[model samples]
Target: MYILLILAAITAINLGKAFGTEKSITGKSEYALAVDVRVSVPSSAFSCMKKYGYKTVFVRGYDPTGDGKFDSNAVDNIHNANKAGLGTEVFMTPQPRSDKKGSQQLVELYEGLKNGDIKVKTIWVQVTSPVNWFPDTKINIDFLNDILSAAAHYEVKIGLYTNGYDWSQITNNAAADKIMLW
Candidate 1:
């Protein structure tokens, strides 16, 4: 009877291992490591990243140049990352002094993503550069709100990428509670 019980326990353990439940039993985290890149990289790089256990990559999607346009390599990088079996996300650096409004910039980004047939859950807005924002907190707040509204208009989410000091300087930490921080 004791031999039969031992055999049954061993079988259960093997079954769990086969079903990939050993990690849960071992208390191993299922979360993935992520990296953000501003420039375009080749597929081989992404493959290397995956082999090294990077599960997600955030690629820059917007170019804050004259009039502000989508980054030329954003779509291709996203596709490459996906093909390499890594989860992909996009971030945009907005130019406050550009001719385009915040909403217009977001429109360009959204349309670009749509045209590329790329889907992203959220577009993280980088607000780290102090020179990119106005000195008046109210204007900065309005600019962020415009982007937020644009995100909502397209049924997409928005996240902020800023440190505490930059956040305080930019919008006085306004709307901090409304969006996810990265």
Candidate 2:
């Protein structure tokens, strides 16, 4: 039981580091926990999450398939989260196989968020799931570059959501050192 407790503590520390919830010199977390959701949640849900110690929420901002449009609930979700006293951010899962270019995808999301009066500080781009990426590494790199270029035009920060293996398979770890990782 003591060993299990030790392992749990180690896991928690690693997760804290990954989420930027660094531990202070006094051994207490300097930041509160965060949560991510892809669906529209009630305002009461966000209040409960805050009550449980969550400080932030990341909402899905785009839908890549079918209509390839912004998520209908993203604005409402962000407002609800903010109303419940949680910091809100947005994330997009790019569709590399679609006919649309990366820049076009990002523009659609950015404009939608802007029209809804949702100010996004950082847009986390999910680059996992090899099946969602192009088979050619160069194509994947170009696609990611397009997204980066468009993000620059909008002046929003971009974060990558990927593991080493998935990243290697998708873009051969291109620009891994530059962009923030989630």
Candidate 3:
């Protein structure tokens, strides 16, 4: 845990360092940025990802249906992101899922990415739907706990994506060091 914090801090510092050591937006030398991608986002879109100078990225690993497996475009995104010299992290949309089911999905995503040799800087689980309001606190909290546990077992840095209120309610004050907001 302490190591993860140290690494995160180092990464954060490195991220900000990319913009040069001048007084800037965050008023801190250490800042970080992340970009989101899905299977539908073609590798061509990343041709200029390096220009944005993001230090981290969130790439989708699963699609919502049918086989419910690894996304076809994930590898291309990972490859392109790597080519752009950005650290990549994988995420899965976890809305409308139970704790048990969400945990399984998390594990499945990890395994699928590993099988494809697509290692990443971290794993992020999505807890919000951009289109709809997810109102079930119990389900959200449960799912978060399960995913957190699975993430620990996998020994990888883990984080979440949600709007404001949903984060506090869904995580129930879970001790995650990183939380991305909508």
Q: Write out the backbone clash pairs for model 2.
A: none
Off by over 4 Å in 3: 1-34, 40-44, 52-55, 65-68, 98-100, 130-134, 168-182
Order of all candidates by lDDT, from best down to worst? Answer: 2, 1, 3
Model number with the top lDDT? 2
Best by TM-score: 2
Cα error, residue 180 of model 3, in Å, equals 7.7
| Cα distance off (Å), candidate 2, residue 10 | 12
Candidate 2 TM-score versus the reference? 0.82
What are the RMSDs of all candidates, in order? 13.9, 7.3, 8.7
Off by over 4 Å in 1: 1-31
lDDT of 3 by residue, 40-128 (tens): 44444554555655576567886656535657767777877777777777777764443236667777788887877876547766665
lDDT of 1 by residue, 1-182 (tens): 01101001111233212455455565333456677776777888889878988788878898888877888888988998999999887889888777678999988888898899987679999898888778998988888889889999988889887889999999887756556666
lDDT of 1: 0.79
Q: Between 2 and 3, whose TM-score is larger?
A: 2
Pairs in clash, predicted candidate 1 = none
Q: How many residue pairs collide in each prediction?
A: 0, 0, 0
Ordered by TM-score, highest first, the candidates read 2, 1, 3
